[model samples]
Target: MKRRSVLFSITFRSAVSSDGCKQSFIIRYTSAGRKKSEPSTPIHVTRKDSGELGDHLGNGHLGQSVHLPKRGSSNSNLGEDIDIPLNNPRTSSEPPRLKFTTTSRPLVTKILSSSDRHPSANCPNRVGAYTFGPGEDYLFSEDKVYIVKNDRIISSDSISKMFPSGPRHVNAAVYDQEREILVVIEEKSVYGYKRKGSDYKLESVYPKELPSSIAFTPNAAIRWHDKHQMLLSNGGMFALYDEYWNKSLMTGRSSSYFKNLPDRVRGISEWKNGKANIYTQSLVFIYDVARDNVAGEGVSVPDFLRC
Candidate 1:
């Protein structure tokens, strides 16, 4: 079955500085249906040197007329058409012309080396809980609490730092609003510093006898729980910790240890009905934390959840 997409033009008016007139307008069009409950799309207007309606810029101008090919009544391949009216100003013609700007699929290729890439990058495991920054610039990795900016770690050191020690863990960092601090969670301990003028002053260290698996709860809260909470797993479980790293609110693991199963914690989330979701390699299990028992069958996340 063939689906048809219709394109329509929408224009916005702004006063051109040269003419000092509000009547002059720039128009934009798109066929995409109802963008976020708003019909308007951005218009790109390149002013011609002459500043006239009919001025023939080298390639094409806003008001130039285009001629359509005589084949199918409706066309999809833009190559078949000639100069259609750029802004769809009416012209005497038999076959109606379509005014479309030339477009091409942008080509992108991976440039990072295998050693430089993380296992989680561009993978289905992207199902990890995330906290989006003010813009789409960075996501806070609860595992580490560091800033993952542009899918790369933000460093206090230079790129050469990667040669000796590799990239700093952005996953172990979190921004604290209450204290205005950036907390860094290392493998076996937690450390934080206050922002004093332009430098970071050392804060207290929380040594972990057993590091609880940490996950960011909804409403931007942090939750930790682990074997101390009687949840047993091979690798570790996800949990939330207080500022002092005292205890965990929840944990993801079987109440009794499984000898055959190497239960490594993957991700943690809370869904509707007071349910918390915990992910292992190939399974997603629902836990009723209040009751402290596994509640639902595991569902597999698809292989294409990568970003």
Candidate 2:
């Protein structure tokens, strides 16, 4: 059976500026059940002679005579279609579409190496616990807080500088881009560190209203901002805010396609009790892990549960 997909038709009209720079106006249309033109602002591009990357100057400007493709009428390979407006003030035609090619199998499977010595050679056992620094662009691991540059240990010369997780294990860690600080999360508390003259020292520790586990939340190294407190991906996206919660954020899900936050990464802690839970935007799944991979919808809300 053909899978269902909501297609978004985006159109960008390009023109060469007087200075030989490319300028474009973006127009978009979404077709699920009804076709509707999305209002967008005109966007300006950088001068070609500037030797810089292409970027929009300002917000998108609304365009005139928007055209939406007729259902099942697009010349492109995308199967879905929609009805266009009758009096759109312009001729109804399909907008320019980008062509996509599909291959039966992956072209390059080995990123670093295909030796199979590790999952992918040059990758550590605990990849989901990896963290990157701000500005310096250095990588660190959450297990022993090993700082690596080109896979070489560049952590502070002192052994004590490492933030090992065992007694008061680091539940989570993120780099604050704006402040150039490293924020660390523990079981019940949070800590922040900033680079001083030569070494990073304790900057602050927020002790009020720290996010707690909602059944499977502690499994999530990163927490969410919604009141639902929903997050259960092993490796997920994080937005480090001055205020702890109630901010815009994204996390991992079980879709096999491209995922915003990775939930299927390896090197995760093993599940206990032969039982596991899955969280989605709308539903939660409970699965028995010991025997067969049998999962049931609608997990029972426990009266008294531990994080």
Candidate 3:
């Protein structure tokens, strides 16, 4: 197997001071597995008045603040800068100690704040996830679904209205992007909804009262794999079901793999190829579906995903 190397670039910026002494440094590196190698030393650069920074060190001197590109601008290569404060004392002979941090693109650009619209204490088990349909984006929260455009909620509707009998408390929810379907599991039933315009139309509902080979508790971590058209749930045990809720695989309670899984599963997600990431509070297990065994386990959940 050919191992791929991932390239990473980090930018460090000093906090703006009253004296306007701000500095920005860029570091580029590549990593494969546990080995990491830096391609170049930190390049110090200052920004021009036009909000673009010159990469060459001769363009600007150190201790000068650089203007970052405007938010949502086309030329914005670097995202939000992690501000490193230089308030601590440093000897003149020693280089200024710098702290490095990470920043990601904002998940929600606009704040959806409303006293009555917020998550309620009465509905403590609210489930939400991002789903897209047609050319529009949407966010499903509990019984309500909101139309999101340009990372902002533009409109909202109650999906419960489409239900036969109002809204049932959702236990877990996962969206199948490939199939354009949203599956929501309630306490006593599993419901599938198809995207219809800005709203979701109820398509199928499987009652839990029916004898099921796979049992799902309230704490089960559910994920839908569109490639296989299968639903996976992991509570205290592991199980796999088809789109119609027919159980295809179920690990026995006494299985060695089931015995090793953590008591509380935080979540489950499809990983690279045919593997799945089973997340616990402290660790994540990479399970290969074909082999029906764990491929690997790691304590750093984010690092595993990066690989």
Candidate 4:
């Protein structure tokens, strides 16, 4: 069966300037009909201030339109379409807009080397990485924090400088953009850092050990939810916690439609409308936060990520 196209929108903020002003842009795209021969997908990127649009051809070039292959096209590297709901509201009078932009090179080129392995590594993990805006990604590894810009590591700093006596092995980290704070999770504690001018200041710490219901692990994944709580998952179990380290709920696969699946959760990817994609070793499924249940059947992991 032919799957319907899905619209995706991404917004990016530029680094703060000396004067405290910042620039931002939006990228919108759709996985629609496909052509047979063309291998690249076209993306539209729009500047928020000027409303100017730029076309990004998947080949790392701008201002060109590229055709995308059909679904399940063996010749194409683009994976299957995921039906993500567009969160931005639009009126009937305005036409739909699509935009796109990406780093010039892949972001994992340097971090995936065999010699650079760390104890915190987990399959399909994104624990210590957070993207604050376009071309800005912060990676927490061991006692160091690296800043990546335009797919390249620009600078790094000792974790101690950001959070005095911080954990040497960060299990999970996330940046709350709305609150302008960085949250770090270690073995049994959570720390929060408020963004200062060009640095971070330790603001709060939860010294209490985490409950057994959602204990920290190398394989754990966390994302800040819009409802002001952290959504965390490990193996097949999921839990929610507030800033005070209070656990409000605990759930597992046995309570959802995916109960028959294995109890191995590789990672969690947040999406719009209080929904998230839970990735296992071989399959990916949707989880709805509002319903606290699996929303759909599982799909095979994309071929690109299998590598």
| Top-lDDT candidate index | 4
Of candidate 3, the 10-residue stretch with the lowest lDDT total is 118-127
**How would you encode candidate 1's per-residue C-alpha lDDT over 1-307 as one tens digit per residue?**
5444433332323213354332222222223332222433234444433333332322244343333334345666443212223443323424557989868978898565554544554333332222222222123232222223443434213212211122233223334444554444334344455655644555555323334344332112222233122222233433444554446655553323322222444434423365555545455566665666667566653321213
Model 3 has an lDDT value of: 0.46
- Tens-place lDDT per residue, model 4, 1-307, is 6555533222122222344443222222334554223212323233332322222211132233434444545543233332222233232434667888985976564344543333332222232433232235555555676554433345667667756656665655655555665666676676777766776667755444566666544344445344444434454445555555445475444335233333455444545687666555456567776776677787654221221
Tell me the TM-score of each prediction against the true structure.
0.28, 0.32, 0.35, 0.39
Tens-digit lDDT track of model 2 for 1-307? 5444444534343233567655443333243445444443434465543322222421133344544456557556353322232222223234457999986787765343233222211322332232345423222233444444332333422223543221234444455545665555555355666766555676544433344322222233322212122223444433223424423243333343222322432111113375433322222244454434436444221110100
lDDT of candidate 1 at residue 46, scale 0 to 100? 43
Candidate 3 vs candidate 4, TM-score winner: 4
Instruction: Please report, in order, the local distance difference test score of every candidate based on alpha carbons.
Output: 0.37, 0.37, 0.46, 0.48
lDDT of 3 at 284: 54
TM-score of 4: 0.39
Clashing pairs in model 3?
A: 22-65
* Candidate 1's TM-score: 0.28
Q: lDDT score, residue 216, model 3?
A: 48
